[model samples]
Target: MKWVLPSLLFSLFFFFLNCTDVDYNEKSVNRTSRKILIDASHDGGVWWSPQSGTYSASLPHQGKLMADFLRSYGFTVDELPSFSVITDSILQQYDKVIRAGCFGTYQPSELQAYVNYTNRPTSLFLIGEYLNPAQIDQLAENLGIHFQGIYYGNLDTYAPHIITDSATSFYYNAGSIIVNAGTNPAIIPLGWLDGDNNKPSLGILQHPFSKILFIGDINGIESLPQPLTLKIFKWLFG
Candidate 1:
């Protein structure tokens, strides 16, 4: 958790850039009662320390800011310390879910539980890392999407969707791209890596009663433009 001057300053630049999104929290507070579960159970590092809200000012603390953003929007944010079975008792509680990382394998019933949950009107957001993505890909495969490739820097393409409106200039510390696996009617590309529509940096899977948005980047959440992040939450829980 230590930092040198130049490297610290560089990270700080993106930190403040992302922190500016904290204002979006004030923009809309107590707006709705939508509930969200940030599945940090798999040892996901995308969320904050809970103890350190957005005030920590460190780059990683930006995850805390994301939680604050949700709170400001009047959504109840919950954390899952384990990805065991994802029983209906737990899945039924939240209107939306965001899974940012996974270190271990997922239970077969858990994947089926998610599939069952999506049979209703719900939304799920997935963030992928450039490093080991076996577990992430496994879950994604069950959901009809795939994460592939590895790279760092700008995503290089965008869609006309509201989500992409605020993510025009998204640059990442590191990330991956979603592979184009045949033609799944339910899947739509939200953003691409270098103008290749087949490979996406951001994609969404449309289910009968649910939608799953996948971000092919580890730092995608923390590094996402504030406006873009705000729009995504609003669209998901709003």
Candidate 2:
């Protein structure tokens, strides 16, 4: 297997970015272990993109890493195969739901199920392209959260192994994020097209959000040493 970028660096990037001198209630942030659900189901069990390759490979490699990492961070993690099967009753039991950026469309009922889940006060980590913009907007509005970026057709930033385009960068960048408008603005601004030539490329919006963490790029989580990922699991879950 070819490791395009060391997963250790990627993990660290997220950890440090979230560890600045922000006045988060250390006690509150470190409360009891939160239940975290990893959503990996896609419509038709595949992701569709104009780019190329099989849909099975479109899922984020970081999902497993993130789950294990979060587990180390004092949180309980579970890989959910089908979002449709995860009913509202099951969702309400968890504290956090990390959306692994599914690239396919959802059945009307499935979308509605997500609606019910977001209505309550549950922390959500959305990674990847926001499929079905309409449903996304509805959920965002309900949650009083807003994420910038207009989707232009389909830009697949994964195949070429370059962060210069959405088509490739999105393989890693396609995950959902925490968009805090009042406190942390959109830092590490990402788009399918670079402004000058409009060519595809990965860009970071440099605004900090929630506490001191940057939304666009998670430096610490992405760059942590392999051992550290386990350390993070312990921190978040222990």
Candidate 3:
């Protein structure tokens, strides 16, 4: 009876030690509750815009890599119908939007819907590129940010911001940005391309309600490290 009782105690202790506590939670980006919408190009996905046959970006895979990266984390990502018009209801459902203006035409109402979305505390990642500046402008104009011409590359130049410490140098072909005066005064310029007159390659808007990380290079998004990308998203969502 004495041996039997000791054996039972030992078995119980081993079971408790070996069992995994599935109930415990790890500290991570609180992004699982936030929903993301990828509304890029005129098509279904973000991969359609800002492309040149391996020549445009540092290494061109377009938006697919970014979309995959975001999803690799637990964030919920969705695509609007390529032909679908953006509306208040749709935008409201998403915590953030990832946009690459390549060939999409935003109706006046859709732009207004975005205005409504941003009027609240919403965030966005606006992708930029050298090609189709006009098309990119259509979506960005609503936010009073404009994407301009090209710059070959930059070794590294960063503003004092959260994502700056996450990466060493930006390695992609990027475009320039001209942020308007009256808009998000909390503008923090992120990176620059040094080839043509120190053109700015990235901009971040850190307003209380409207958080935007405007990436001026389509290929730049493709080249971003996952930790850096998550940090950028966390900042935007925060």
Candidate 4:
């Protein structure tokens, strides 16, 4: 709640940047060119913090990294506002919608809009600390996805982890999932809250969509190296 001012400011700034000169029609009509929208707007809290303070909401690195990665991937990558503004018209233009970083406190209308987007046959890559209970439930209600609560201080205890489950194929050496470059049906488990915290795991989902690969807790904004990010961009839209 206290981070409202900077978060709103950042969101407004993002909305204007995309709305002002972005020829959505032109971008959408490029049938051969795949498009992906990276929601790098960081208005959420950190691992230990419950709310991202006003001063900490300006996470421009997320936009910078994702845009570069998608571009390299040969996809027409556009950084969208929060999922709240993602309407049918907007959804038609992009192939994948990546919720990068924290999905913090957004307006009710925006949340409703995002829920509708999830209902359709679309792809969403939710990274980092996901969101709170209400937003998580909204995704499940619309897209049939749900997150398990994270154990408190699990990250500290289980340092450098990796996922070896057959259902969830990952490539990283540490964390719950690995970062393989294959087209496998995987859900990269990212964040988790304590039983008492009970928000949602970053990688759990009810819908078993193909290509649902999650690279657990790797803050594409804070962690991914710039070069690897470029590779990801090239793979998406470049």
Candidates in order have lDDT scores of 0.67, 0.41, 0.63, 0.42
Of the candidates numbered 3 and 4, which has the greater TM-score value? 3
Worst 10 residues of 2 by lDDT: 207-216
RMSD of 4: 17.9
- Steric collisions counted per model: 0, 68, 0, 31
Model 3 agreement with the true structure over 1-238: per-residue lDDT tens digits: 7799999999999899777433211224453455778775343233544543222222343565766666656566675434567888888888788876545567888889878887887778887656443555666766767666655665366666777665566566645454452344765667665533245567776655777788766665666654556667667653
Q: What is the C-alpha RMSD of each candidate to the true structure, in Å?
A: 14.9, 14.7, 8.4, 17.9
Query: Model 4: per-residue lDDT, tens digit, 40-80?
Result: 44424322133233322224433455456445545666664
Task: Give the C-alpha lDDT of model 3.
Answer: 0.63
TM-score of each: 0.74, 0.43, 0.70, 0.44
The candidates, ranked best first by lDDT, are 1, 3, 4, 2
Which portions of model 2 show Cα errors greater than 4 Å? 1-28, 43-62, 82-84, 130-238
Say which candidate scores most in TM-score: 1
Task: Note the residue pairs that clash in candidate 3.
Answer: none
- Candidate 3 residues lying further than 4 Å off, grouped into runs, are 1-27, 43-46, 49-61, 81-83, 102-104, 131-136, 179-186, 195-198
Best by lDDT: 1
**Which lDDT tens digits does candidate 1 get at residues 1-238?**
4658889899999999887664444655324446788775553444444433222323335366666666666677776654434676788777689876654667777777777778887888877666454435667778877666567767767788977775666675567666654567777887776677666777778877886788877565665476777777766765
- By the TM-score metric, which is better: model 1 or model 3? 1
